[model samples]
Target: MSTVLIVFLLYLIGMVVAGIVTARLASKSLDDFILGGKKMLTPVIALSEKGTDMSAWLLIGLPGQAFKMGIGAIWAGIGVWVGSLFNWLVIATPLRRLTGKYNALTIPDYFESRFGDSSHLLRITASILIVFFFTLYVSAQVVGAGKILAATFDINQVVGMVIGLSIILFYTMMGGFIAETWTDFFQGLIMVTALILMCIVGVISIGGLGNVFSRISAVDPKAALLSAGESGTALYLGLILGGLAIGFGYAGQPHILMRYMALRSEKEVKKAMIIAMTWTTFAVAGAIFLGFLAIPFLRGEIADPEHITLAFAAKILPGWLVGLVLAAATAAMMSTVDSQLLVTTSAITEDIYRKLINPDATQKLLVRLARIFTVVVAIIAFFLGLRAERLVYWLVLYAWGGLAASFGPPLILSLLWKGTTKYGVFAGMVVGAITIVVWYNVPILKNFLYELIPGFFLSLIATWLVSLFTAAEQRRTK
Candidate 1:
């Protein structure tokens, strides 16, 4: 075998071994399998959140946008950084405390407990949403993994996808959250290292930042503008708002929030927040710069702009290093997919099966059900990935918008507003999800603004208004 193949295989082997070892620690309980027994330390939680948050979007989608659009792409990065900072500062501690107090294992469970939903309506609705949107979300990551493997190994895309999905399912199903968290910690480190190294190499090769901008200007002067080449003021402003709205989605993402919920203590949240924010800044900056730096080296050579980072790595790095970097890119896809898989499994086994179907089920039975659901969800996502036709960025954004709109407003309100009722939370979720579906499909609406922008506000309004009306009715009846 070639040195590259050997190196890549060894990395995969290590991940499999790690999964098996962590599986031993999972115990027979659903809590240990899904939440790592709530014992994750500061670094593990911080890095796992970062790893799961970035996904292949950091490696492929963001760089592709920067390469295609210019400095305007930086707005998305800024939005995410700011959004994450706020999420950590405002949401982390309260959420950690609330989940612990209520003995909630999932986001849906938190909503159910906080609002006193004895009917299990909120839990069912939330799990359905999780299953629906997360299927598409996980599929996007699968598609990304396919792209990475195809580019690196010259394999068929479908074949590459199967290989990637198989490995992800193996580790994730074998060890659940424990395996996913440890792998995410390692993958997070690799992701940042790969991005930083790629950026440094690209900058040096192009001579400097000045040369990079000049080359972009030479190609399309307007492309170098931060305003995204829009002529009308309204259009430019809209573009900026839409890009920044990407951050709003962060507040509601269940996979990222799962990291916060898994924290050992509320006090550790502050430390994790600092580490996460610092890591995000460097990682986002590096990914964006990689795109700008690729202008001179890969202007016309590659067909798909998303492949810029991988192609750039192969051009500059040695064989073993190239394999490692490529593996890191794959790591970006796997880390996110594994986490989402585990979350989806929890929704099915804990929320749907245990809570709704068999309230008396034993811990051993729940763990077994979780494992079965993991494989089932992975298979479903793999098929969806095969059917996916959009670019990684759009696919991810579409699913991101849906989940953010559906869950973000309700989650925020539940934690911050005492008036938030079960009725209001339910309304917010339904309206948010419906708006995304309608807005995204309509050409005019989608062209004007991202689905998340409208969906988020509408959902917030629905939640608040319905909550107030219901609270007043309850007072009158009493």
Candidate 2:
């Protein structure tokens, strides 16, 4: 075997060991499995959240966007950064306090408790949405893993996806949240280091920043523009707004929000926020610059722009470093896929099965069922990854929008507005999720703006309007 392959194997073995070690901490109950018993420190929680949040999008999708659209794609990065910062500032502490206060284990459980939904409608609805969108979201990450593996080993994409899925499932099934979060912390460092190294090396390889821009401008003037210059003022405004709108979805994403719920204490939120934002800013900047630098190196020879990072590693870096970089990229995907897998498993076992099927089930039984569900979800996502035809960025964004819209509005209202009722929560989720689906299918609407923008605002409006009437009804009934 090549030296690169050997290094990659070593990294995989390290992750497996991490899983086995953490598995001991996850034996107490479902809470332990899903949230690491809520004892995670600041750094582990922060890095794990960032690691899960960035996924393959940071390494492949975002960079590809920058390469294809030039500096204009910076809007997406800025939006996500701003959104994540605010999510930390506004949602993190309260969520940590509230989840602990209510003894909630999952997002659905939080909703059910927050809204006083004894009927279990909110829990059931939220659980279903989690499973639906998360399956697609996890599939996107799986597809990215397939691409990376295919690029690395010259294997078929389907085979690559299966291999990737097996690794993620094994660790996640073995250790649950403890394993996933700790692995994510390690993976986060690898991801940021790889991105920064790729950026620095690529810039040096292509002469300098000045030469890089000059070459790109010569190849395609439109690709070098920072804004929608010739695309008209309306288009420019739309692009900026749509890009910024990406941040709005951050409030609603279950996978990311779960980190807040898992924190050991509300005091840790401030420290964790600083670490997460700093990491995000640098990591995103590196990914974007790496994309720009790839232009001069590949000279437009590549068929898929998303594979630029992996291709650059294989071609430009030394043998051992190539393996390290490849492992980092794979780390990005695994960190995310494992978290989503755990969340999806929790939604089924914790929310649906426990709440509806058997309220008296033992902690041991629930933990076992969670493991089984993890395998089942991974298999379904594996198939979805094989059949996925869209680019990674769009696929991720599509699922991201759905989760943000469906869960975001209600979540925000529940925390801030005492008047928020179960009816309002239900209305917001349904409207938001439906809006994303309908808006995405309509070519003209999607062309003008991203589906998340409309869905988020409309869902907020629907929730607010419905709350007025529902709150009054709740009062009168009382």
Candidate 3:
């Protein structure tokens, strides 16, 4: 094979071996496997958490989106930064305290206990959604890895995906969460380093910032401006708001929040939050700069956008450096995939299988089942990855929208609103979940309706209306 592919294969093999070794060390029990025994150190937690949240979106999707949208794409990163900060500040401590108090191990478990343990149907529904949507989400990460392999080594997409998925799956299934988190920590560092190097090389290649921006402006003035050529104030604000809504997905995401729950103590969270946000800011800034700098070097060929990082690296960097950059791309996808696999497994084993199917299941048995679930989910994701035909960003966003709409409101209401009844939470979830699916399928709404707007609002309204009606009916019966 080509030298680039060999380099990538070597790096990937090392990661897989490391993951397997760590998984053997870490996966003694269900708790250790699923939640890292709730004892991840601050640095480990921070890196793994942030790295898992980023995925290929940071390395590929964001830069690509920025290339396509121009400076307007900066708003998307900013929204994520602000939203993450808010999540750490507003939800971290409370979630830790409450999850510990309730002895809840997963997001769905927390919901079931906090809302009322009368029946676990809600938790089951939530778990099903997590598995369903996350399989699609994980598929996107696999597709990203395939793209990197295809571009870097000239491997076919299908072969690349299989190789990529196998590496991630082997480590995750063997090592579980503990193995995954430590891997994420090292991968996070590599990702940051690669991006920084790319940014530096990219800027120098294009005659510096002034020349780059000037060329971009001359070619696509709309892209250079934040307004994307819109002159109206309302239009600009809407665009910004649209970008900001991305953050709203943070609070409801099981994978990231699971990291918060895994903190050794509630005390570590404040420092962890700072570290995570800072890392996010730095990585996102570097990505945007890379996209901007690429404008001059790539010219018309940058139309694909996602190819900007790889294209620039191929042109500007040497064979070895290019290998390192490709490894970073793999790292980005693996970081996110590991966390997602853990959360998906947790949703199945802890939330549904044990709680509903067998409340008295042993920890050993649960751990075994979790491993099985991890493998099964990975296989499903791989199959779906084979079918994906769109940009990684669009595929991920659709799944993200479904997840945010379905769980975001309920998670928020549970924390802030005491009047929220079990029925109300269920109503909100149904409305939110159905709204996302319907809006996605209905040609009219699918075209014009952003999932967040309708799904979020309808969920909120459903919660309020149902809670009121239930409460009033109870009062009358009394």
Candidate 4:
């Protein structure tokens, strides 16, 4: 096994150093801390958004799915890429303009301002949902870190978890939004480059694309076919639907949405959309290839399929090169957790504490409180990581479904439909959240489909119906 630990150590140090370097940038005001005062450049926002969205799931979870499910796993890659494209094309510019007009710093704040909800109901409900789902999402990232460390270094899972968790909290506390964004941009590059490099090397080692397919086909006849890897047409249909399920979530993610909001100008988002989509093209293809390539080499031997990326890297790459790949995978996890922590903190500090509790709160005080809440949230997530109830993939999907279902319908509809009422959006969020929780826990329902599919559509229906009912009443009142 490749035992070069120094590369991983250096990567962790680099994350903390980024935070220290950006500390001065975060100290000026709440806007600066939360969104870089809307001054981030195009490349920075583009790659950072990609990095935040990819997470360790790109390297760990997706590959694991492809490793186990064969060629049919492409559904997930397609889902994310198409979903992301939709979010950029449809939601980015208008959202930037709306948030700018409202002077809003967080999603909840945007909700209140956009809908003229002076009752604070929209703001509080949105904030509560953000906190609830983001904390779970961050916990999944923490869990990914532990899994990586344990697999790479042969360390106890708890120790590995703590090491990864502590660095993320420290760096995030040190620099806030700008720091994490900058870190994510760099980490994003490392993740893509490493994943692609591994794919190229694996393809070459396997002799050629033809050989790879034949070998995997030798094991399972349908494994090489993109449309179906299992026996029944029914099984193929299930794979496609379940894989595409989470695509609906891209429009709803607060951490990813924040990147769009922080762009220097709305016009720049077009250029950024191209850059980000190009990055996604490379990253997703690499992940999918990695998983497929590993099926011939590591199938049935590995205990945890999610460890396939690192295990395969150790098998093929040199000692130091493997270390670099390990760092890249680790970077994927850190890039995500830091952003989720900051987004969750903003929900607590900016949306709730300042907007609701004390309108007169100073920028410095709110920033301090944000840092404080960042710690509290990280601590809560750390314990959840220790529990390790599910694999990193499922945990992320559940949280993604909740956030997407609850927030996606409301956010997307309000931006597009003038008739969307505050009460309607609130009701949609509640229904969406409830559907995910219920759908995820029941085995029959969970097996029927990916929870996000039902949750999202149901939420959309609730939003449209409730808005139709309430809009006329609101007009009567006015």
Pairs that clash in candidate 4: none
The best-first sequence of candidates by lDDT reads: 4, 2, 1, 3
User: Given candidate 4, what's the lDDT at residue 283?
Assistant: 96
TM of each candidate vs. truth: 0.96, 0.96, 0.93, 0.96
| Model 3 Cα lDDT, one tens digit per residue, 1-478 | 3566677778778777877677665557777888888878898898888898888888888888887778888888888898788889988888888888887888889888886655676797888889887877888888878877876677698898888888888888888887788889888888888889998877777677667778788778787888766778887887787788788778778898888889988899999988898888889888887777777677697668888888888889988778888888888998888888888988888887888789888877887898899999888888777655464345566787778878878777778777776678788888888888788768887655467778887888897778777766534533
Q: Score each candidate by Cα lDDT.
A: 0.87, 0.87, 0.81, 0.88
List the candidate 2 regions with Cα displacement exceeding 4 Å.
209-211, 228-230, 387-397, 476-478
Alpha carbon lDDT at 288, candidate 3: 81
| Candidate 1 residue-wise lDDT, 1-478, digit = tens | 2777887888788789888888877856899999999987789889999999988889888898888777778888898898899899988999999999999999999998887788887899999999987887888778778877786788998888898888888888888899999999999998899889888877777777668778777876766788868788997888789778988998889999999999998999999998999999999999888887777677789888888887888888778878888888889998899999998999999888888899999998898889999999988888777765464345556788888999999999989999888889999999999999899889999997889999999999999999998997535533
Top lDDT model: 4
Clashes of each: 0, 0, 1, 0
Q: Which digits, one per residue and each the tens of the lDDT, describe model 2 over residues 1-478?
A: 2988998889899888987887778878999999999988889999999998988888888888877777788888889999999899999988999999999998899989887787899999999999988888888878778877887888898898888888889889989999999999999999999889888778777787668878877776776776834488888888798779989989998889999999989999999999999999999998888877776667568888887787887777888888888899899889989999999999999999998899999999999999999999998887777655474345556788989999999999998889888889999999999999899988999897889999999999998889988887867645
Model 4, range 114-212, lDDT digits (tens) per residue? 888878999999989888888888887787688778867888877888999899888788788889888999999989988988998898898987798
Candidate 1 lDDT trough over 10 residues, lowest sum: 387-396
Name the top TM-score candidate: 4
